[model samples]
Structure formats: C-alpha cells, structure tokens
Target chain A: MKPSDHDNEHLLHHFSDMDQQRESAKLGMWIFLITELLLFGGLFGFYTFYRAWNPDIFHNAHAALDVRAGTANTIVLILSSVTIALAVRSLQLDRRRRAGKFLLATVALAAVFMVIKYFEYSHKIHLGQLPGKYYHYTGIEGTNPHIFFSVYFTLTGLHGLHVLAGMGFIAWLAIRTFRNHFSAAYFTPVEMAGLYWHLVDMIWIYLFPLLYLVG
Target chain B: MAHATAHKKPHVLPLKVYLRVGAALLVLTLVTVAVSFVHLGPYNLVVAMLIASLKATLVALFFMHLLYDSKLYFLVFASALGTIALFIVLTLFDTLRRGDIYEEVSRPITPDAVIYSDTARFDTAHGQALPEEGLMPLDTAGIVSPPLDTGEIGEQVDTSDIGRIRTGPGEGGR
Candidate 1:
C-alpha cells in the first residue's frame, strides 16, 4: 500500500480513491430510492385497483379532501427539489456559501410543505373525516368510503414521514456545507441527499392528484 | 490515477432546464385538477393516474437524476417495481376470490334469520326516522340501547334445533 492509501479513512479502503467511493455512494442511494419507490408502489397499486372497482366512492372521498392545499404542497415540494438541485450545482462549483444558502432554502420550502400538510390533515380530522374504521363521513353515497380513506391516509402518511426524514437529511447536509466539508471534488453527500429529497417530492407529485385532485 | 479521475469535470444541469421542469410540473398539476371536473367514467380515474405517473416520472428523471444514474441502479429499480407488481396482482386476485367465497357461504345459510329487525327497519326508512312507524322515536334511544349479548345470539342458533340451525357446524362451538 502506498502513502496515499493511508488516507483512505473516508474512502473505505475497498475502492481505489474518493471518486470510486462517491460513485458507489451515488449508486447505493439510487438503489435505495428504487426500493423506496417499490415500497410505495404497493400502495399505488392498491389505490388503482380500489379506484377501478369503486370509482364513485373513491372520487367522492377524494373530493372531500382539499385540492388547494394539495396543489400548494405540490408547488412547494417541486420548488424545494429545484433548490436542492441548485445546492448541488453550487457545491459542484465550490461555492460553499451559495450552496449553504440553497440548502437552507430547500429546508425552508420543505418546512412550508409540512406546515401545509399539517393544516390539511387537521382540517380533515376536524371535519370527522378519518381513515379506516374511524371515518365518519356518512352523507356521501358510496359502497365503502372507508376504503378510500384507508388508502388515502396510508399513502399520504407514509409520504409525510419521508418528507420529515428528507428534512433532517437536508439539514445535516446544510450544516456540513457550512463547515466547508464538501468541495468541487467531494460533494457526493449533497448530491445523494438531493436525490433523496427529490424522491420525496416526486412521491408527492403523484399523491397530490391521487388523494386530493381525484374526482 | 483515481485522484486524476476525481479532478474530472462534474455533470450538472443548466438552471434553465430546472426552471422549465418546474413550469411543466405546475402545468401538469393544473391540468390534472381541470380534467377531474369532466365525467369520463372509468377513464377519469385512469387519466388522472396516468398524469400523476407522468409527473412522478418527470421528477424522478430530472430532479432526482435517475436519468444520469448507472445501469445497475436502473436494474435495481426495475426489479423492485416488478416485485411490487406481483404483489398487487396476487393480493387483488385473493380479494376478488374472497367475494366469491362469501357468496357461496351465504347460499347455504338462511339469510333472513340472521338479519336484525332494527337494522332492517332502519334500512327500510332510507336511513331516516319514519314518524309513522314510531320506531326509534328518539335518536338518543337508539344510541343508549343495551348492547346485544353475543352469547344470546349464539345460543339462539343451536345445531340440534331444526328451525334455528347454525350456519356452520363448528362455528358456534368454538
């Protein structure tokens, strides 16, 4: 082993250097994201089947949900995704301060998404519209409206948890950026976190329509 | 050699592309909401889901950089999706088959005997209180009624009894 091999603490010693480590990390994250998509895919399939079988019930239940809030959240998540991409770009350019600013913006946008989601959920619960056996909306005519609420809450709740997780990840990346931990040559952390954040945003892109915009 | 590779140029998308992607997403959201108002029957849900899937693809491709990922990552993603597809098909088959099983079970039993008179009356009223019948005159009375005893219902249907027979032979015994 050469003297350069001694500095392989960050490189994991298995790969040749930092570039390989970065590539591996990026690949691993993509694989993890694929699994995440699959995890949610089951719910998506459930929604598809139930909606196909009981279109009227799903549409009526979906109408009870707030489309305006969902649309606002969709925009918020999309903008945050853009900001995180820009943060990665800034890091690639070795603009640490600019990168931190973009990351902070991304975090703020994520907070906005969560705040909007919180209000939407509280409004629904206040109106006695809950998931599963607790659903109380009886005026609407449907075979099993509870099933709609069941899938709605399950999918959106899982997506919300992911958004929370992404917020924490972005915050950590922001802190590291502030400390000048990433450079043009070593910004894989920011890139990987951006990918995860984008996945969270992507899931909402589908959820907004499936849950709130359905007629 | 690896250090030299690390010094190579990084891949980055232009700001304009990001802006355009954002605009496209916003447009798609509006389009989906607008399309929901028209009654397309079965197609409405299909169209909505398709648009949502398209939106997800855009985000995954441009925002998440799946477009830039290596082939191995794509394979991993494809396999996961394939597994999820199998899960969906199998579960749906089971659910659909359950309805058939329920119908077969109901055919062997006398349904009218198992029906609750109060429940039947409530349904007959079109989910409203019929003033003429004077049944359940007060809303609170229905809610405050004593809970039905499971043992009583079970005892009423005995296997040895001819008129009131258990639907399943081993059901009540357990």
Candidate 2:
C-alpha cells in the first residue's frame, strides 16, 4: 500500500475506519445545511403568507425595486456558484493553482453582488421607504404597502448576511489552497464550501423574481 | 486500479457542463424579466416562480453536487423543503381565510366610495358626503352633542367613529 494510504488506515477512536469518518463528516454537513434551510424557511414562510394576504399591495410596493439591478445580481451570484463548484472540482483533481483561481473568482463575484446590493439598499433608505413603520414614501397609494417592504428588507437582509459569510469562507479556502492544505486525498473543505455557496445563489434565485420582477 | 479506488475523489462534472448550467441560469433570468412585462394577470407570478424554481434546481443539482451525493443527503434536503412548503401553505390558508382584512384596511381610504354597514349617513356616492362605513364617524362640528360620560371613555377610541378620524399624525393605523 502507498505510505499515505497506510497513514489513513489508522482511524480515529470515534470512527471505525476512513470511510466511516468521511461519510459521517459529509452527513453532518448536510444536516447543518438543512438546519440553515429551516432558519431561512421561517422568514420565507412569513413572506409567502403576507404576500398572499395582500397581493396588490405587494405588487405596487415591489415596483420601487430596480429590476435591472436585481437581474444583474442574480447573474453575478449564479456565476459565483459555478466558479466555486469548479474550484472544488479542481481541488479533487489535485490542481491547487486552478482551485485557488476559481476561489478568487467566486469571492470576486460575491463582492460584486454586495456592491450592487449596497446601491439598492441606500436608494431605499434615502427615500425613507424603510420597513414596517418607517416607510415614509408616498409614491404609491396602496393598502399595507409597508408590509411589502418589510418582507422585502427582511428576506434580502438575511440572505445578504449569508452571502457575506460565504465570502469569508471562500477567501479562507483560497488562502489555504495557496498553502497546499488540500489535495485529492482530503479536500472535503472545498466541497463543503461549494455546497454553501450554491445555497446562497439558490436563495437569490428565488429573491430576484419575488422582489423585483413579480408581485 | 485498486489503489486508485481506495483513494477515490468525489465526482466532478466537466467544466463544459458547469458552463452550460450557468448559461441556462442566465437565460432563465432574462426570460423572467421578459415575462413580467407581458401582463399575464395572476399567471405572471406563477410563471416567474416556476422559472426561479428551475434556476434553483439547476444550482442545487449541479453546482451543489447533490446529483452525485448520497441518497441520504437528498432525503434531508427534500424533507426540509417539504416542511417549509407546508408551513407556507398552512399559514396562507389561515391568512386568506380571514374576513374583512382588506375591507377593513381599504374602507376608510377610498375617497369616492361611501361607507355604512347598517345605514348610509349620506348618499356620498351621489352628491351627498361619503358615508363613514357602517358607523358614521363625526367630527366635533358634525357631532350634535358631546358623548355622554361612559365607562369606555379614555380607552381605545373606536376608529370606526368619526370623532377619532385621523387620530394623530403618528397614528399610522388609520
């Protein structure tokens, strides 16, 4: 057997073997991802119920959101998800330099998404179109308009926090790749990071239409 | 071959497949924007959500590597999503089933429409002043006499009455 394979065979006390350890770690990550889904799911449920209750108000209020900007961000996030997936693939092939480059691309795309979001949020704040009671703008005369912005801000704000966290993870992973910390033998970190980054993109996929395109 | 199998790497889709998925996602986004302008009435929302769902599925299956992962991971994700969907549906059922949520909100603000559950204060729809809904809310000038001392005084003013119409500048509920 190869020296590395011999080293891997000495399993930790908690794990019966290398296969068990790897499978358990993966299953743990999946469980955590679902829990994260549930957390966001609650807020999403809130938006769904309110949207159904006041469909017209949602329609009128969402007009203030810039579709162009939202569309751009959606594309940016999709690109980032793709790059991160590529990064994981590169690491699995033991291409450290390629993996690092893809990680950089993913981080760059996430930065672009946040920058666009900053402009969108600043515009809303400037107009005093704040969530709940702070909504002061009168551009549209509709019932319970504030509720729409309330849901909008709440959903986007939470999703944005996830994006920020994902960016931090990608940056760390990239730096680690530069140090040759991952190889085909053990590259679970890159794969896990890729999973998380895709989730961020998946959320924005839903948000883009709900907030900007449709009522 | 046996050595390579023991040291196996996780499955990775080709670069071409990833690029193709990215292209499809971008195209679908554009389609969403285009569909919004067509004015499909209620269907507009349905179509948009469907497209968004398609994009999300692609990202999850390809980019997230769920397609190549174990069935156990699939089960976890599916159950979470199913539960979330149930929560939304049940909450919406409760909310949509309620009575007068919209009527209560819109009755006061509609300038042209008259209000009055039991009787019309005036034929506001005609030349008469708009009714205050089922209850005629009167201003001080309109009030024939001061309300008599009542146990309910200094308590929550019934907004349905005109005496408290436009309660205060900060009172956004009205």
Candidate 3:
C-alpha cells in the first residue's frame, strides 16, 4: 500500500496502515507478556510445592516480612501503573506535555518502589534471613527455615528486575515524548510500554500478599 | 498501490475510563491487604487470590486495552493464564497428594536412605566387578555391599563425608 497522509512515519511498510501496525505491535507485546507470565508461573509452582510441604514454616517465615514496607511498595507500583496508563492516554489525546509529566511520574514512582525494596532486602540481610545455605537467622522455628527465604528472594528478586526494566521503558518513552516522537497519530511505543508496566505491577500484586501476608 | 481496505481509526478510550479503573485498582489493593489481616484460615489464600485476580483483570481489560482491542489479544492472554493454572494445579496434584496411596512406600526415599547411610561401605576394590557371591537381590535396607577393610587400601574414604548429596555410580574414581 502507498503511504498516505493518515500514515505516520512510525508506520512500517509491512503494515497496511497505522492501525494495523499499532495492533500488530500490541499483539506482539501481549505474546511476550504471555511468555513472561509462564516464566513467573514456574516459580509460582515451585513456591506452591514448597509452601505446601512446609506450611508451618512458611507461616512463621512470612511473619518476618515487613507488612508496612510491602504495603507501601504495593501502593507505589499500583500508582505507577496508573501513571503509565494515563501517560498513554495523554499521548493518545495529543497532550504531549501532560503525557511527559505522567511518564516522569511513573519513573519516579518506580524509583520509590526500588528504594523501598532496597530497605526490605537490606533488613533481611541484616537479620541473617538469607536464602539457602547462607541462612543464619534462628528466630523462626522450622526444619529448613532457609526454604522460605529461598522462595522469597527468588520471587521478589525476579519481580524487582522487571520493575527496573519497566522504569527503563517508561524513561525512554518520556524522552521520546518530550522530543515529540509520539502523538495522537502514533503512540504505539507508549501504549506497549504501558502494557509492560502494568504486567510488572500485576506480578507484584500477587507477590505482595503471598510473601508479606500469608495467612 | 491503493488498498481497498480502509483501516478504522484506533480507538482511544476516555481518561475517565482510566481514572475509574485506577481508582478501582487502588481500592482493591487496599481491600486485599485489609483482607489479609482478618485471618480467614485457609480461606485467606482464596480471598487474597480472588482479589488479586480481580485487580489483574481490571488492569488487563482497561489499562492494557484488552477491553477495547481485538479479541485475539484477550484469547492469547487467557490461554497463557489457563496454561499457568494447569502448571500450578498439576504440580500441586503431584506434590500435595503424593504418598496418598502407598503411603511410605510411594514416597521418595530421602538422600540419607540406609543404602547410603553412614554405616554403609563403598567397596572400591570391586569397582564395577561382579561380586564373588553373584548378584544379590535389590535391597533399600542399607546393606548394598559388605564393608571392606580401610587399612588394606592405604587410605580411608568416608562416604558419609559426601553428606546429604551423596553422588552415586561414579564414585569409584575417588
């Protein structure tokens, strides 16, 4: 198809037009998110297996987690998701300045999430509630107290990496938005990044309750 | 070349949609955290998971645009979720119901099974050679081979030193 006025420079030749291109990109991103879900699903399975085996131990070990910090991080991530979604919406409306601000807010919230995560991890390290053979905390009564920490570190550690990646995505979108690279005609990147950010938040939504508030 | 198909303009949802979804998500987050504190026994997990699922659905439908986008995206995502459910459920089936039938016999023998127990001996002299008394019946009762004299070999190899992770079959090289 020949390039037309409706088609922006962002639209690739492989697609019929901007709509097709945007939908294709979003589809691809969703597929990638599926794989990401499966990856975390495996860990979730491992967690379930161990949690079932050591119910009492899991119950006790989870108590060591700071509910306040976890709750704070949860709110931070949810708010970040909101900001990224708003950023996409703003871009769709051709409000470039507002979109940039929303993107910046998302990045700032992501940093706040990481800072809280840093304190949580350092506190665990201090208490010697380390995973595997390095576990030295004797406060919890369990045959293998390290098992809970092992699952804890693996789940949250992986999720933290995703948070950092999401931050990078939003920051890049922010820079691009400020440069006027995205507008109402083509904001696929912003939308795709929003999807990625929301997925990260979704994973944490599951993680927070499982890790911090096991009943 | 001119194409016959005219692509419809991409659907842009209203800001109100986002704000409402965002508010719902925040409220649900608070609800999940609050529910966690109520001590619902086993139901606590069920409630937590249900609330989390609801929040995830809202994000997927509104924030991620699945509600406004093509059904293909929703199908692809739901399939992934179904697969994950299978993954977790099948794993739990194996682990949670293990040893339900045969009890102790069906369960996996621990690494410290008597055959690899502290008192069990590794006859390095035999090293893949058939026993002089011919093949013995399989026994997990810890008596796989007779104990050999350590002094004759000039070095005592303590199998127990391998601890919980006793390597099998290829230890003859040591």
Residue A159 C-alpha lDDT in model 3: 95
DockQ result, candidate 1: 0.28
Q: What DockQ does each candidate score versus the true complex, computed on alpha carbons?
A: 0.28, 0.34, 0.35
**Model 1 C-alpha lDDT per residue in residues A1-215, reported as the tens digit of each score:** 34544554566767766666777898888788887988898888878776655667786777787777887888888889889989988877778999999999999998998999899889878876776546676666755576677788889899989988888988988999999888665778889898888888877877877677664
**Relative to the true structure, how large is the alpha-carbon lDDT of every model?**
0.70, 0.74, 0.76
> Per-prediction count of colliding residue pairs?
0, 6, 2
> Best candidate per TM-score, number?
3
Model 2: TM-score, first chain:
0.94
Colliding residue pairs in candidate 1: none
Question: How much does each candidate deviate from the true structure in C-alpha RMSD?
Answer: 10.5, 10.2, 8.3
Cα lDDT tens digits for candidate 1, B107-137: 1112222232334333232332232232323
- Taking chain B only, the TM-score of every model is 0.55, 0.57, 0.55
Best by lDDT: 3
lDDT of 3 by residue, A62-136 (tens): 999999999999899988998998898787778899999999999999999999999999999999999765777
